[model samples]
Target chain A: MKAFQSVAVIGLGSMGLGMARSLMRGGHEVRGCDLARDALEKLAAAGGSAFNTPAAAAHDADVVVVVVVNAAQTRAVLFGPDGAAEAMKPGSVIISSATMSPVEAQEFAARAGEHGVLYLDAPISGGSARADAGELTVMASGSPEAFSAAQPALDAMAQTVYSLGEDVGVGSSFKIVNQLLAGVHIAAACEAITFAKRLGLDISKVFEVISKSAGNSWMFENRIPHVLEGDYAPHSAVAIFTKDLGIVSELGRKQSFPLPVASAALQLFLMTEAAGMGQDDDSSVARLLAQIAGLELPGMERSN
Target chain B: MKAFQSVAVIGLGSMGLGMARSLMRGGHEVRGCDLARDALEKLAAAGGSAFNTPAAAAHDADVVVVVVVNAAQTRAVLFGPDGAAEAMKPGSVIISSATMSPVEAQEFAARAGEHGVLYLDAPISGGSARADAGELTVMASGSPEAFSAAQPALDAMAQTVYSLGEDVGVGSSFKIVNQLLAGVHIAAACEAITFAKRLGLDISKVFEVISKSAGNSWMFENRIPHVLEGDYAPHSAVAIFTKDLGIVSELGRKQSFPLPVASAALQLFLMTEAAGMGQDDDSSVARLLAQIAGLELPGMERSN
Candidate 1:
């Protein structure tokens, strides 16, 4: 596959910045842009150009990757006044790497297509660490031409790219499905850990035992350590799941499908957000459970 | 560990039968009992004596293991007419392998103490396959002497024995916590997969993506195959989670702790059981979700 020689990465947040560095490392002339000046400066210091607007970044790019927070931000970056889609060349691809609904993804793809740009419905996973390491997993689907155009950036930014199909919405559908389970498992992990604390078992011991047992999940193994260490610093914040699972809930409602587990998990994230821990690590939900139950977790002072 | 020379295995169901064989394999003279004649005959063929009653099996045995369905059956086997506790010799140990509440386990331990018998609150996990392989994980708690008396059988039947504490109820508490997550995860797996189907994504592809993604749990990896192949034959049945998560809900209520995710999962299992899939594989909850959404899952005919 021929590598895109010039790439634009919009929304230089944790994930986007890491991906921008990865693209630069993969021999692309990368241009980065974000609302945060500090993030843009970091990208500039890493030998890539930084821009104040998506349009400035995408003006001469072979590929424009929109890695924003949600569908609205994605749309704003792509089609807002002086948007990247307007600035980019016709044959260039726009890789949309936001967790959103399939319908929203299809809408974005159609809008990009109208601008004579190829669109790849790509949603990334594996967190910021893997993103920085060029090892994220990308669930991607779009036209063959879009895939061909985005191949270099995808190869640089992802360790595995699941080519879902030619359908524009398929990648987002898979991502929403994944978010459904990830959100639920995180809630379940928090519930289990705090429930063990309520039951008077040593929370660390419970973690050790459960991680080796049938009750273990990816979230449990990954997030329980934050609880054990009493570190609520956000690797992935509680608000993220609230947003992602909210998307799942919205889509489920639109499809008339009952997503009771996802809905239940979404409530936990909402509760965590309501408790003022939205910006903390998602594992802070365990502390929220401990607080409601009137129990003290390791490293957490009683909030009341 | 001094191996108990004479052991009685009451309740020769899947888990009990496997433990009985493991004990016999460990060079113990095992006496087995079950209501099912087929289970009894299988035990007898394995060179263990099979009895029609718990007391008959416990008579002259140094250790009696009650591996029944729940606390009710555990109580029946230990204290009912012709009970094993009455038949077991003084100073012998009664190892309870059933999953129940901490309160129930404490009560059982006290009653065993009244009979001048050592009691070990040991609730086994790792399923029947692990049990048959002598590789189950046991969450155990009891007195020093009780641990000493149960060590031989514990070694024979389990790969990992988590000595939670000397407190009689500690093991059961840990087991309940494990069950809380296990049940929720299985339900979440069902919810996520069926929701994918409802969204019109390929279910098998969803399974492939999820198992490799952060959405995965031990339950998801182990049980999603049942959904993928449309084979719902019981590796573990729906009624199992109904009972296990019921214990979690009951315990949570008693503790005034809100287990919202687990509660939601419990409702799913209850619905699955109410729909007459109680004896089907636990993954059949996926079928229930598909039915509710009017979606067809692989291997499941549309019930409507």
Candidate 2:
């Protein structure tokens, strides 16, 4: 692989910014654009070129990585005001890393193809920590040409890149499936911790036992500390699950399948969001449950 | 703890038989009873006395460890014809190892007190293998005397013994809390695997990606292999969750707290059971979901 290639990272949010730095660390000449002035300034401070529009950042780049929020935002970055797709050189690859439905991924692939640009459906996992370390897991699929084109950037951004055949949309399907379990597990962790508190258990003891026991999940071990410490900071916000599980609910209904566990979890996130904690960490549902149950959870004695 | 004490094991099923042998390995004089003559003979072969009834088994025992099925069976062995509680000497302890409601445990503790016996509300976790190795985790509570009397037996049967307090019901409450998470995780794992199948991805690949991803759970890592290999053998049966989650539902309603995720998991177990897999491994819910979606799961081409 070439030690250096021009790469455009179209968003510099938590995940995208870490990925931008990771790309630079991997010796890629990185340029990025974001609506947030601070984010663009941060990328510039990290010695990468920063721009206000996707077109300007992606201009003359070998690869354009769209790390925006959903299908619509990804679409916007590729085709909207001063979008990257029309400006990206022919044969250049567009690596889309949004958590969108397979159908949306397929649509974007076709549109990118029409612009004579190769499109790789690449959905990433691992939160900001992994993203910063260049250790995210990438679920990706596209033409072999696209794979070859995206190889250097993919190597820079991911610890694991699954080449899921030459079909588009498959990577998104895998991502949505992952989001389904991730969402449900998060809600279950919230439910379990609050339920433990209601039982008059030392909630911290519950965490220790469950961490070693069969009840444990990545979410349970990773997210329950927020509840124990009474911290509601958005390590990952409750609104993220609302969006992801909404994608799952939408996709499941499209297939005529029921997602009882995930849907129940969605209700919890939705309920928490409605209760005004959508911006808080997803573990805030535990607080919501505790508040409703008239139980005082740790770190919650002072709060309403 | 004493190296030698007369102990009666009231059940000799998978978990019970292992506990009995573990106690014997700890140098206890173990006497046990079970309806299975093979179990009784196995104990005899191990040089422990195996009687036909609880009373005969409990005769002159210093500790009577009741490892029966539920609250009712525990009551049957302790109070019904040829009951162990009456047969046990006064001041001896009874360690109850059934998954029952806290209220039932409290009631049993009260009744055992009437028989001049100290009752320990001790519910065991970790499966038969752990039991056989004397490495089970015991969530236990009772009086100070009950803990002191049960210590030798507990040391024999468990690697980790949690003295939840002097209250008889707290141990059961902790166990129930553990069950709530365990059941929901199992169901979510099943849902994820089936959803992956519907997405037309390699199901084993889903396992590989998810094992390292945030979607992972103890149940997912432990149970998804059964689905991949298409083996439905009961490592832990589906009926167990139906029963355990039933207890959770019962207790949650009693506390007036909604258990939506656990309740969803209970419905999946119930649906799988109704489809005739109650005795199969809890992961059998994955097969049920595949069957509904008309997808062929591994090792399932031969079955209806």
* Cα lDDT tens digits for candidate 2, B108-158: 999899989999999989999999999999989899999999988899999
Chain A TM-scores, candidates in order: 0.98, 0.98
TM-score for each candidate, following the candidate numbering: 0.98, 0.97
Candidate 1 clashes: the total is: 0
Segments of candidate 2 deviating more than 4 angstroms:
A301-304, B302-304
lDDT digits (tens) for residues A1-304 of candidate 1: 4555799999998999999999989998999889998998999999899988899999978899889999999999899987999999989999999999989888988888888999999999999999999999999999999999899888899999999999999999999888888889889999988888888889899999999999999999999999999999899999899999999999888888888888999999999999999999999899899888898987888756
lDDT of every predicted structure (CA atoms): 0.91, 0.91
Candidate 2 local lDDT, residue B1: 40
Weakest 10 consecutive residues of candidate 2 chain A by summed lDDT: A295-304
What ranges in model 1 sit over 4 Å off? A1-4, B1-4
Q: Write candidate 2's Cα lDDT for A49-117 as tens digits.
A: 989899999889999999988899999999998999998999999999999999999999999989999
Q: Give every collision pair in model 1.
A: none
Docking quality (DockQ) for each candidate: 0.89, 0.77
Candidate 2: docking tier: medium
